[model samples]
Target: MEKFPRERIRNFCIIAHVDHGKTTLSDRLLQMTGTVAENKMKEQILDSMDLERERGITIKAHPVTMIYYFPEEKEHYQLNLIDTPGHVDFSYEVSRSLSACEGALLVIDATQGIQAQTVSNAFLAEKHRLVLIPVINKIDLPTANLTLVKKQLEDSLAIPADEAIATSAKEGIGIDQIFKAIIQKIPPPPSFPDQILRALIFDSVYDPYKGVILYVRMFSGKVKKGDKILLLSSNKTYEVKEVGVFCPKMVPEEALYEGNSGYIIANIKNTAEIKIGDTLTWETGGTTTALPGFQEISPMVFSGIYPLNSSEFEKLKNAIQKLQINDPAITISPESSVALGSGFRCGFLGLLHMEIVQQRLSREYGVDIITTYPSVIYKVSLRSGKTIEVDNPAKLPDPSYIDHIAEPYVKSYLIVPSENIGEVMQLISEKRGSCESTESLGHDKVIMHCYFPLNEILVDFNDKLKSITHGYGSMDYTPDEYRISDLVKLDILVNGEPIEALSCIVHSSKAESRGRSIIHKLKERIPRHLFKIALQAAVGGKILAREDIGAIGKNVTAKCYGGDITRKRKLLEKQKEGKKRMKTFGKVDIPQDAFLEILKTDTKQS
Candidate 1:
């Protein structure tokens, strides 16, 4: 009902490693401010998705506006809290949230101290010039070591040990202290109301009733209902049907000014009309200058997603398009597999991202789908002097036409306990990683820097790191460069026919081993039938590995048991001849489970 001065606004985000209390802290903050009623309070109020709540992780970045009363100053301040995803897969989400805020609450688990993501996110916040408020969360646990964690924050992130706020978000302890620190420390957004209208679209969601709703942060101007707005990137104009702020839910407001974060609805019919980093301004501003958008996120993993029933293809496409309205990071293209029918070649940020997308497609859309093994994009230089990018093995060109292949590389950073350094180093080495440098972090921990092929670590590197370190290791990575390497496309053939869905591009040095493992797994998965099946792994035209599946046992000789040996031999010959004919005409029924199993196997092996 009352508008606060620009100086009384505090825009901030809570960021941390997975399961480090970001959502919990956000929930407590909402409770303290009474934005959410005590009886209505729930765990992870910002994580409205069932998947996020079930998994206890934040998948999407959520923004909420709360009013906090400052007794000392006798004033009310508008506090905007943007909660971000903690997993490395959603780092880009964290970056976008930071861009909308002036400060961030860097939460750390007191029991675990500083993890890899904590440091990585801290650097991102610093890059955006955000005021970092260090907070050690989960202090009520018996294992919480306040002194050690403070030291770790100081030694690792270079934050002042005394400046870190210690709080228990679950028990509502020290929440008032966090509020006071935010009001006194984090500065308000810069006031630029007189300037041309400019607002950043940080997030969006698709509503069946309202179409597309955009969550934005005003940086230079104000917006109101019934005003015409222009999307600078797309050069599209729409009448603002409504403008409001998120009080955990959209509440209509008369107008939204600079230094505020809220939503805008313009009757957008499709998500393709707007982009996450696009700028919005007054339709007649006559200025083409756009605000700085976020860096485009490139997908790190690729797979083929196909519906179980071919008739559901249209529904699958529509569902994916709707999902992309909210999550634009996923990349999709048309693809067809002889064994799996029509499908889309999809790209994702990471394994978790790939899994989440699959889960959402099945759970939210009620579509049963099959996914192929995940792979990374490869840069292929042909002898004809043209460089092409390939994400699917089926699209790989002939080996004779290829000059060389270059794969993506990443600068990987890992933090592990000193006792597990040897095991971690060995694991990296096995993944074809080259150590760049190593630094000691206190007496019991070490930080390692390495360069690894994107494909090599795309599958099970993180799982292996955790297993070897007994769950004490964390990792973060950034794309470094692309380097030329010896690569080959390994194809799987069943009954002398190659299955494009099972084909994969692998490094030449490990081609034989990987091919053998694939063929062996395929043999176990292909069921026994009336005809024997021959499974082969080939590179180009050369067979690298092979496996044979024997035909199902039958009682062909039962009728000739009392007869002479000649009669039995005749029956056997006839049965063998029949099997040969069946082998030529019969097709192998590859179950959907087989495709999923192969992908899971690759994760376990690679």
Candidate 2:
């Protein structure tokens, strides 16, 4: 248990786009530094979630401390490297992780060059004032064009091309260069150990035995096992149970000093008691001044998450609350649906984030849930000039009572190969988005500056963009100003009963097409019943799309094949009468999957 001086420590993280080999680069660092033993090593060692590993995308931020011997100086330095997610949905995770570091490694694929998140992450690192070292990864690929990529580094990212380091993370090449760059380029944390305690809680996780394990960055001062610490956000004090550092795993440390990024357990029982961006100080003599916390992220996507079993509502609630502790970026509130029973209206950064939360609930908490159609928070102005925000289409006021609806839009950065720009532009028009400007980068890739309604791209925009570009396209977006649109409420009816859960807000121009797709998808999922079930999508009492689920029919004439025709007619009329009565009283047995099917967005058209 040794404490290192702030001068010999460097805190850094890797930032890049999806599939840019960030995790692989991180793996190389751990291997080169010998932080992880050869026998214990695995691919994407930092990505702990099964989903992350399966999808080959980092879902959560991971931190580890590595001891590197600088042969030139003949001294060991402690490098705290936090691996972050590359997807745009996890941008918030990247931002919070950056707040704890003094530098970052901006990894770009040499084969693919600079993509969407490379720019977004670089912007984030600059905002945190972190020194960025650009690393061009995957140089061993046959398609690797280091020359073109270097030029892109200067043109698109404005970074000097010579500053970029070329390496193939998969082949374990140039590992020492990254370490040398980190030590020679990145500066030590600016901290005052003699001053009163000031640490920022950037992230945390819940443990059944330890309660809450807080991941922290010590800005100044020091903390020990027996020290009493106060969290400024909660205004509560607790005795530190233990202190440790992430050596890929929890390695107990005697004391955490200034510039150290580590963990603290204070026996805090509830996650609500400890805020992610809260500041920590000594319980008695600490200064009241709090470190600048992270910006509160507003969810760009909203959906309802309901458990399959109604009585398990509490179980789902508890599960979501626990998850919220780990990921505070998600917005949660109690919401009930007439068709789906009780559930929570959850808000997420994007569709991927929402999907992750739903999967976690099912896998981690073992809760089978249904997710409603995703929507964006819209600004609705009533005829009386009173404006309100609506996240759910069912909550939207009637068309007669509303004056105009403003939908959220994003300034999107879409980069694609030159040949696919035309198709990409056409796709943009299909989604009700416009290309504000186009800038050609290097020789082949073009960056399209587009403004798209946030809701228009929620479902499968990224997927479609990738398909059209043959997987060379990438997009990153930030919320832009809300604009008034010709919008309407599209509601679905099941056997003459309005299903609130299947309703969504849509642009009036696309309502008919969207409705037709939804009902068709629903028809595929809805099971045959004894009585005919009608599925309709309507707005203002006018049906825009209709699909029928035929009843499970029995051949009334089959049994009377050899009998008289009059007898067959009597049997057929009786059967028809029974069907009419059943249709009046019988309910459609819609599967949980059908709800998702009805809300399944047709991304191609959207």
Candidate 3:
């Protein structure tokens, strides 16, 4: 195989809002380039994970190299296409993907003019100084508004409406036009073969047989088999076992050069040794400076995950480690719950990310686990003039020990139909959000900016926003400074014994109502036993609400029909004494489903 000139390599990625036809456009591009055979073509070829396909969302960013034969130029160009996730949770992934490219394909749905994320990701591409090629997708739909969408692209993004390519990715219409535009509009990557080897590790995955495989883009020099390489971040050296490019799949190559994207295998046994955004260079080379890496990603939502059965704890641990190899954004720490036993307090970028991780553990690793309700980190200021960050409700200090508690906040950006402005504002207001600003995008679209507690919007804000806006709303948020708030820890007790796993941090204003709802739900789920079970919700040892599951009735009077009333009363008294003793010494066995149900319940509804 011959190495293509660096000037012929066009490295770019597709970025857009969720359900904006990014993956579909990628599939059409692959087909036009003959990279994938027609018979083997499938929907969302870049989305390899089953969860991504089933959920109709891209959870991970994927890269593939294609050979496009430009008929006009009568030459073949090497095109590298990176598909990125559209959700805000994976915005970090989008930023890293942009670093490896010189251009980006900004796809937008024709029916949905300009979404919050489309604007957010467009600014991200501009931040990376990548060339942006606007593509209006789904043009074949009945409700497609090409004129309005084109105007939106021009007004919001400052991209010329004429430059935007109209396409129907589903029907393969205007695909050839898109291909032509790519050749003319997108610039090629710069070559730096004279410099020492410096490859940026954008992504990686662990394989049981091959160990850790790194997906990287070479910005300088070359890497080949048998070459000794050093990970600059870790200062670790290893011999390169193989180097290859992904033609939709890993294909071994003799070497990878500048302006190329490919994979590198160095016989890495432990995933911890390889870090995303780390620089890879030749061990003996003179590359003194490393590439500017990505910013550290902090988790926005946290929950405790435990194995359903205590014996499967090791399996759960191993499964999480394996999953972490592919997804480094998750943060996990060991935690022990008095009621749920051993578990890990896991942190995720958002609720979707949390759900995906849980589903993957169950589907891929067959690990049945229970997860607690999610919470955001809080800063608690103590009377001693010291402040501590608390991520778990069980770790919250007593009310008397703290001066004030601060919770994370976000600057939320929302775009919705103008007619639904009232509904959207009401929804945000209900979540403790305050209007920061509002702007009119056009005749039909309105942009609203609000400041909201991060915990308030982490769970169902998006769902409610869409519900009120008739699925025409889009939102993006960035973390703001933490502010002092009236936060308290709500604890649940079963049979008068506190269950650490069922505790949650909530606003003091809603503690009473939330507590009542929790106890009520527990009463319906808990089973009746020989002894009555008491479920109570308390805050700082003051019980706010309680519920009781009546004990199973046993007839003591049936055998004493001919006896005196006093004899019956004496038998009842003896039974009451036994019940009292059982309530004091007997342990209540809380079912796993009960814990799961509590976590799954929407706190707002509760």
lDDT of 1 by residue, 315-375 (tens): 8998887788778899989888788888898989988999999999999999989888888
Question: Would you list the rank order by lDDT, best first?
Answer: 2, 3, 1
Ranking by TM-score: 3, 1, 2
Candidate 2 Cα deviation (angstroms), residue 166:
1.6
List the candidate 1 regions with Cα displacement exceeding 4 Å.
552-582
Each candidate's TM vs. the true structure? 0.95, 0.92, 0.95
Task: TM-score for candidate 2, please give it.
Answer: 0.92
Compared with the true structure, all predictions reach lDDT values of 0.88, 0.89, 0.89
After superposition, the stretches of candidate 2 with alpha carbons farther than 4 Å from their true spots are 309-318, 523-534, 547-584, 591-593, 600-606
Number of the candidate with higher TM-score, 2 or 3: 3
Global Cα RMSD, each model: 2.2, 2.9, 1.9
Off by over 4 Å in 3: 191-194, 530-532, 551-557, 561-566
* Residue 339 of model 3, lDDT score: 78
